[model samples]
Target: MRCKYPIYLLLSLIVLSCQRKDQVVKRDNEPDIHILQGEDTEMNTAIENAQKSLYKFKEAIESRNPDYYNFALKERFNTAGSGGEHIWISEVQYSDDKFYGIVDGDPISTTEVKLGDTIEINPHNITDWIYIDKNIVKGGYTTRVLRKRMSQKEREQMDKENGFTIENE
Candidate 1:
C-alpha cells in the first residue's frame, strides 16, 4: 500500500534549522527539509523507545480524553531506489491491529501519497506516535530527541510555534 505525508520533513526541518542556524525559506509552500543519517544511534534509539511505549498512546486514545488532541503517528515508506522516509499521519485511529489516519504533511521524497490522503498502517511500520494534552506534548519520544538537539532559543521558538510545551524527560 502507498503512504503519504511530509511531517517527517517538517520535524527534520526544525531540527535542521537548529543545527545549521540558517533561515528557512518557504517557497510556494514547500516544506523545509533535513536529512539524517541512517546510522544515527540517538535517533534510532528514540524510534525504538516510541515503539516500546506505543501502548500508552493506544490506551490514551481508547480512553477518549477530550484533552487529547492532534494525535499523530510516523511510519516509514520505502521507495524503489531512494530508500525510505519517515512521515507523520494525523487524526489517527487504531482498531483491529491497524491504524487509519490522514497524511499530515506534503511528502519530500515519495510520490505514492500526499497530504490529506487516508492510509492504513501496520504497527510495525510506526516509528513514532504523539498527541497533545492540555497544551503539552505527550508520546512524542522522537520529538523529545529532536528538542534535545536544539538550542534553548530554537526550542523556545519551536514550542511557541506549535503552541505546546515539551518538558524535559
Candidate 2:
C-alpha cells in the first residue's frame, strides 16, 4: 500500500520473521517496508487468529462505543494474474450483514482499488482487524507479527510515530 503519515504509516511496516529471509525495501523518504511471504507460518497463524476474533471488532462498531475508534480491516485484493496484497480499509461500517469502508492507502501490487475509495468488504478476504482503545491498539494480530520482526529501535520509532502503543499480550 502507498505509505503516508500517522495511521497509514503502519501500512508500510511489513516484515517477516527472522527465521526466514524476506525482501526488505528501504526508502529515503519513508520507513523500511518489507514484503511478507504468503507461506510464512507465523503470518498465517496471525491471520487465522485475526479472523477468529473478528467478532470483537464487529461488536464494538455495533455498540457505537466512543472509546473504540480507528476501526479498520486488512483485506486481500487479487492482482491481475495471481496472488494478492492485503490492504487496510478504515472507517468501517457494518450493515445488512455486509461491511463497507474507505481504502486507507494506495495500492502497491493491485490495481483493483486506490486510496480513499469506498468498497464492499468480503468477509473471507479479511486478514486482520484493528481499533484503538484508550490509546492502546486492539486486535492488530498481523501488525503484532510484523512488529515482532523489527529491531528494538525500529519498534520504538514505530510506536513514537504511530501515536499509539501496541502492548504485548
Tell me each candidate's RMSD, in Å, in order: 6.0, 4.3
Q: Which regions in candidate 1 have their CA more than 4 angstroms from the true location?
A: 1-28
> Which tens-of-lDDT digit does each residue in 1-169 have in candidate 2?
3222466676655332332345776777654656766688888899999999999888988988777777889888887556677788987899999899998756666788898899999999998998777777888888888788779998898878887877565
lDDT of 1 by residue, 1-169 (tens): 1121322332443222112222343547555544566566787798899999999889888888887766788887765565666677887997786789987667766787787899997688788888777766677776776667769997777665655665455
**Per-residue lDDT value at 16 in model 2:** 29
How well does each candidate superpose onto the true structure, as a TM-score? 0.80, 0.86
Rate residue 24 of model 2 by lDDT: 74
Model 1: lDDT to the true structure: 0.68
